[model samples]
Target: MERSFNINSPAEFESISLQIELKNINEFTREMNLNISWQALEPDFNASMKRFGKKVKIPGFRPGKIPRDRLLQQFQPNIEAQFMDDNIQKYYLNGLQEKELVPVNQAEISDVHFHFGEHFSFTAKFEVEPEIVLPKMKRKTLDVQRMKFISDQQDMDVAVDQLRKAHARIETVEDGAQEKDFILCDLQKLDDSGVPIIGKKFEKQLLKVGDGSFTDEQKEKLVGLKPGETARINLPDDREKTSSSPYELMVINVEREILPEVDTDFVKLVNPDLDSVEGFRDEVQNKIGENFDSRSQQSFERELTDAMITKVDPGAPPSMVDNYLSN
Candidate 1:
């Protein structure tokens, strides 16, 4: 592969003409025939230098007092043929990046020309990503575990219990703490210097015993802790400690769970459109079935894509990858 770059700067424009050719190509390596031509860049460069020269200070010239000719000479390297070469490579690399292409061979440059006060032109020739030979994928029958959605009596009972809990009201208890009871506490952490850390204090921390959010060991330690009782839960040594450390929790009070009665009121709370418990139960069953079916379909599609990629096993060139990253 070979390319020629002709760069020129005119009175009104900066232009580049590129001519690229593929010298060799085969099944493993595809040669690219690229021609990159651009124009009207000189005036933009002149304008940019004019603006930059206003603030730039040069020897023997005060700020904004440098002549255009002097500035042009001083900053010519900054906006010369090499500048266009860099930009051309950028554009070429960007196009290849969009296609996720990897070139196997280095590009060859030839017939590079830069004529001052004339149009700019450049060309680059390089190897392109080889075409993948996709293997024919055969559709195969596979056994998949499928769940049939059916509204059963047990499912309805579980849903009804959840509804009752959602509508439940909290009640202050004068008695001792019990399992599944919520306790409001104040949590804090102090440094070795006895300075309290921010975000360590929780004035109204709610702790629920036997909840999956807490471990069995934590629940055991918290069990039977009464009002105004300060319980210090040790921080896990391996756990990540942030700004808050040396933790301690103070249980202020405990509240008993008062589950609401499962009636029309609970049913209405579960679904505003439902008037009765039976109607809410029916709606829940339908939604569950619909969600299950949607998830199953999505899983099947994902499996199909995985199988296709496995069969194809596409190969990529490392040089192309490096070129893509550099660009």
Candidate 2:
């Protein structure tokens, strides 16, 4: 939506003219077309020159001693550019005030035209909070599902196991790599002729077997690989195709985490407040229950929001979505 209008000048400036056009790019974005007659800017330009004259240095004369005509002759373009840069936002705000608009973001100024004796015109694009109108409810009450949190002994066990692994000690293993083992290897991409490609070799790279981004097939190949042993594995192509390419992986060392036993000493080490394994298990269970409750509540809220959005279908600003996804 766009509309052309003229902003009324103050009674003091009878010769000044302001032409404004308001354009709506979306529900929350707007562009303002602003044009001001040369009569409106001439007085400000003269005042700006006086301010600049007091500080600007000249070779033949002391500060503030240069004539206005001489200064204009020497630096008219620079002075005009500087004056515009310094006061463009002031005029933009004046236009916003005249139109009774509240911008949510900084205005993006573009298509600026400034002629010393003609006019000064520019376009300013900015975002604003959308006006929200609540629709009349079809029913007196809304029926939303309430989600409940549930946990079991198995869940507690898994959570405890994760905590144990998180604090586990790491040691180099001499035997073959197994599940949950880290393999330090040299991975070199192979060409069609079964030779290493130049500049495609990566050394001392650490890969965790049976976990992370590796596929099941990739994990299987690394399971029985021992130090000094090499294997060829097919990995997904970098070009995002279904085809695979072979790479040579030579294991330099095998590393595994040594988890502590679930004893009184271990429980004390994990938490000073808990001296017994039973107490530690109870704390872990409570934490797991809290986590489950949080997840359940979030899921419920998400579903409810989706349902409401489906009913209303309000427009979401693209900038807000981009900011959310980036963060």
| Best model per lDDT | 2
- What's the lDDT for all of these models? 0.61, 0.80
Shift of residue 4 alpha carbon in model 1, Å? 22
Q: Model 2 TM-score? A: 0.68
- Among residues 3 or more apart in sequence or in different chains, the pairs in candidate 2 whose N, CA or C atoms overlap within 3 Å are none
| Candidate 2 structure quality by residue, lDDT tens digits, 56-91 | 888998898889988888888877776675566667
Give stretches of model 2 more than 4 Å off.
1-66, 94-100, 104-127, 134-140, 188-200, 211-221, 235-247, 300-327
lDDT, candidate 1, equals: 0.61
Off by over 4 Å in 1: 1-17, 20-41, 58-65, 79-90, 93-172, 187-206, 211-218, 240-249, 255-261, 316-327
**Per-prediction TM-score:** 0.59, 0.68
Q: Give the TM-score of candidate 1.
A: 0.59
What is the Cα-based lDDT of residue 133 in candidate 2?
68
Count of backbone collisions in candidate 2: 0
